[model samples]
Target: MSDGIIGLIGIVALLTLLLLRLPVAFAMFIVGFLGLWIVDGWNVAAGLLSSETFTLASKPELVVIPLFILMGNVASASGMSRQLYDAAYSLIGHVRGGLASATIIGCGGFAALSGSSVASALTMGKVSLKEMERFKYDDRLSTGSVAAGGTLGILIPPSTGFVIYAILTEQSIGRLFMAGILPGILLLMVFVLTVLILCLIQPSFGPPGPKTSFSEKRRALVGALPILVLVLVTIGGIYRGFFSPEEAAGVGAGLAILYGLFTRSLSFSALKEAITDSVVTTATVMLILIAAHLLNPFFALTHITETVGNFLAYLDLSVLGTLLFILAVYLVLGCFLEGFAMLVLTLPIFFPVVLELGIDPIWFGVLVVLTLEMGLISPPVGINVFIVKSVAPRVPLGQIFRGVIPFWLAMVATLGVLIAFPQISLFLPNTMFN
Candidate 1:
């Protein structure tokens, strides 16, 4: 049989394994190893396994993963996430639907620090859910805002989603980071507008909060200053070329540790837990990256990317139609697979097709990440929905899903805007680097 046919069979088997509840890393590894053995030999497969693991581990860019994760874990353990929520609450809580709006804003801020959708959702959920409940906000508004907002984690600068995309596609990490900024802010605004429109139409869904006195607002802002500084320094330093992403992550993690110590918010045990959590998260990401490397070689051997590129060329669709078709596939996969899994699985096939169509890689990266954000809130496998559900267990799972529907539509709208104006995603990267 042709190696391309073997590659097709391998993909089918990988999907079956995923459906059978096998871990994504393991499934990819198994398929990749076997495919390599078939295309080359057992020796080549064995050699690749060791070399790829070590290469991925030793890469400097990979260090950013653990450091940024530690920064987030320390931030969470130090109660900074709470402070962020409080600051947002103090400023905007009095407005109609303001609390939900604050939750979305807070999630955006925490997302900058955490670079993780799950962490952003979980941290914001724990910090804001009770406050919204106390104010008698509708379960849909309260939970939906948190679930939708958490997706900002992947779109914002310093995002793990962008990092992985950069790694997988051999693109510039800094450029990708820059690319996400404007689009991230745009999506955040869309989410806030969605909340405003929802509350404007039905005031009962979100009642106005009590206005904070100036002094109280001042205090809240002051309390959150440290985290704000950390985010600015890390992201800004990268923008100014003062630090690489890995350096920024190290500095951010160190600052997080110092902030926790100064405030005494993190006890010895809590610090340990933060480190452990960072290690665990980093290990999982590393394994996925390594597995992707294994699978990449298999695709190269089988010319799967070239095959798909040819098929796409044969279709002769306009650029917009072709991009939409790729996005539709992502949307469909979002219903069944986790965001990261879908990313690793599809990028190999679609990325080449994108290049053949003369699309910008960084622009496409932002677009793909946005689609992954939608998946995080999409039904059936909406990871953020479940994360919010865990924090607000009394709310029905269906209710949280119902809540995210408006935000999901907002995501679709944001995707449309980005597509129509690629400049939104490309502007920062082009201007800043140029």
Candidate 2:
């Protein structure tokens, strides 16, 4: 059989394995190894395995993934979640829909350290969902806010998705990380604003939270000083050439551990939990990475990417039309594929199209991140929505899915803003790298 037919068969088999709830890594590994064997016998496929493992294991930027995951787990195990939520609440909790706003901002902050959106959703949901419910907030609004906001895990800096993209495309990891910053922050603000507007139009959507006194708000601000410093230190460190992505992750992890120890939050059990969480998360991610490496060659063999590029060029679609087409495709795919898999599957096809259209890779990276982020909130395969559902089973799964509507609107608006004004996505990377 032709390589093209074999590759297409590989794709179907891989997706079927995933649907059967086999581990994502296993699905990819099975299809990848089988495809390689079918195309080039067991001997050649075995030859590449050792070399592929060595190459992937030694990539410098990948070190950042574990460091950031460790930092996030430490932050979660420590009492940082409350501090983050309280700090946002101190500022916005008085407004109608304030808890939802706090939830959005809190999710963003937590996700900055987090590389996994499901973890972000579960963490923030556990921390804030009850409080939002206690205040009689809309079930859909409260649950949906977290489900939506948690997606910032991959949209913000310290994003593992950006790291994977960089490694896959041989783009600059640092630039890709910075590429996420402005767009992520823009989405955060849009979510908060969306909540504010919802509260204004329908105050019952969120009851106005009790106002806090100035002194109490002051205390809350003071309490969050550690995180603010870490954010500044890490981001500034990256911008100043003081550290590379790996180094910054190391710094962030150390700072988190130090903070945990200082606050007596780093008990032996907590340390074990953090290590376990980081290990599992890292293993899961690396499994996908390895499988994707095998799968990528399928596209390379079939020349599918080049074909898509040629087709797009033949269509002679305007640059705007092509960009919108890419966006629409990701939005639809996001609903089905988990973010990492979605990225691996499409970036090969889509990156070529973006290049053909002369779109900046740095800018397109951010755009893709934001677009798939919505998938984490969209049903019937909304990963983040499921994460929240796992945490708040009392809230119907349907309600959490419905809840993401406003945040979904906000995500689309943020994407529009980034698309309309490319610099919002471009400035940080250009400034930092240039």
Candidate 3:
């Protein structure tokens, strides 16, 4: 049998396993092992497993993964999220759709500190949804706002998604991290605009939030300064070569913990919970990384990426057309997988095709992450939306899904702009690093 045929069957089997509700990492591991055995026999598969697991798992740069995850968990467990939301609300909560806008802004800030989208959603959702609901905000709008907002975690600095992309593509993690800043801010603006427009068109979707005194707003700004400083320092350090990515994570984690402790907010129990949560989340991410590394060799043996490249070329697509095709695939697959998993799974296959087509990897990464953001908010498996629903049980899941449409449109519009003007993503990385 042909390697191509074996590859096709392997893909089908993998999907079938996914349909059967197998865990993603396990599914990849099992199919990859069989595919390797079929194409290269058991002896090669054994050696491949042993060496790939060690190399991928023990790498020093990988230390950043746990550190960043630890920082996020600490913030979540210690209730820093409320400080973020309340501060955002103090300024905007009086305006129409202010809470919704604040939700997006808060999510963006949280995303920077934490790379996990679900963590962002759960943390922010638990804090913001009740307040929005109390203001009689439309269920759809309130829930959707939080759901769409949580996806910012994947696009913002220190994002695990960008880290994995850099590792896989051999791009500089720093450049990829730098590249995300402009696009992340652009996307945040899109969500805020979407909320404004939605409230303008349908006033019932958002009642006026309680007005804060000017003095209160001033206080709120002061409260949020620490978050702003943290973002600037971490991103600045990375871009200015003040530290490597892992070193930056270590610094961020240490400072965040100290900040928590200095305020007398981080108690012993809180600290223990934060460390346990971070350790578990970090282990989960690392395991998935190990699985992806395991699968890559088998994928190569069967020439899957090469075949994908050949197939894309055979269509004689213009650059834009090829990009659209790849985007469509990601959007569909994203429904079943989180952005991080989708990125890890498909980059090996599609990135080769993209590189061949002369597309910028940095630009493509932003576009891909934006598209997956939509999937993260849409039903029947929008994880962030589910998170919002869980936190605010009175808000119907369907309503939350409906509310996300405006932001979803905003996300799509931002994507189109990026697609048309690659410089939106590339110009920053080139100017700063080059």
Candidate 4:
């Protein structure tokens, strides 16, 4: 009878739909529109739906989605991602577990360019998997490293995850982008260490790759320089306050296109394909965001965020304790839900609670994104794991999952370190911009 009860039922039904294989955007749309109509009336629901869809559709900030995606798609078409991976591999592949480390580093570099975990995993897997196979690297370590490393795309700058979080929470996209840098690098280092530890324990898991001659290393670095420069230009420009997030996206996309053409790598057909892919990806993201908007108002009508905030305060947990509890919930939910789905479902309720506790929005965004990264590699529905599986079909799904366990622990450690010192997430944003 109460709005709260109605909201609860709607959430349950939404989850049921998801379990029944409904698309996330449509499921949210159906439940959100119906719940709003039930809570208010058909007229109000119709007005809200029409207005929200148009507003989200026309948002200037949304342009970043397509542009960043285009930059990545074009980069993939141009072989820029492979060049980056080759550069990393040339430098580190000779060391024990070095190939895996190179894969992680390559994933991080590609993450900076693409900002999509699926893109990073798919691209890097195509580039690195065969090489690792040639080097006799264990399929588990090779596939696991690719899957786990790809999760960096969410935390690295130019990330769609940060973009979506910024739009949803009304946080500063540039600041959130800056905030993610150190944490992203930290996580990359942790993953490299995980590879080292795994190889140290079992010497053959990731056998050393062939040593490259100094000339080969130099050539590889030269080949990747264009991408490295592009990454620095876009992310560094934003950090320096020389460009807004949208402008940065435009600049990055333009540069990606020019690079592809100048290198004679992206033909007209490939360029068209890149544009089509970017459009489709951007459209999917926009629809999900619009659906989230619908559900958000319905949740507000039920006072769920307020209710949850009140309950959190009633418990009187210390700020750290409360934060940990929230993250634990994300960890559990990650097993069953896709990362963006979890973000849309939970942020409306939890973000307000985070602010009430006086946490920094930028810092919290990094933490939340990192948790989402965990979910991307989490079991049952680890989307990145599945992406890697698709790339290396010969490797059993269970073995890939098993391989991710060490990297998953590495993620847990990274989370703990960030939690212990929030400045890890905050320092770059504060120092570089403020």
> After superposition on all CA atoms, what RMSD does each candidate show versus the true structure?
1.2, 1.5, 1.4, 1.0
lDDT of 3 by residue, 27-122 (tens): 888988888888999998888888888988878888888888888887776667777887888978888899999998898889988987888888
Model 2 lDDT per residue over 351-430, tens place: 87777668999998888888878888887788888888888888888888777888898888888888899998888888
Residue 308 error, candidate 3, Å:
1.5
Model 3 C-alpha RMSD to native: 1.4
Stretches > 4 Å off in candidate 1:
none
Task: Report every candidate's CA lDDT.
Answer: 0.92, 0.84, 0.83, 0.92
Put down candidate 1 lDDT per residue, 1-434, tens digits, no spaces: 99899989998998899888798999999999999999999999999999999988888888888999999999999999999999999999999999999999999999989999999999999999999999999999999999999999999978999999989999988889989999999999999999999999999999999999999999999999998899989998888888899899999999999999988998999999999999999889888889999998998899898888888778888998899999999999998888888889999999988987899999999999999999999989899999999999999999999999999999999999999999988877787634
Error of 2 at 412 (Å): 1.2
TM per candidate comes to 0.98, 0.96, 0.97, 0.98
After best superposition, candidate 3 residue 128: deviation in angstroms? 0.9
Tens digit per residue, CA lDDT, model 4, 249-283: 99999999999899899899999999999999988
Q: How close is candidate 2 to the true structure, as a TM-score?
A: 0.96
Worst 10 residues of 2 by lDDT: 298-307
lDDT of 1: 0.92
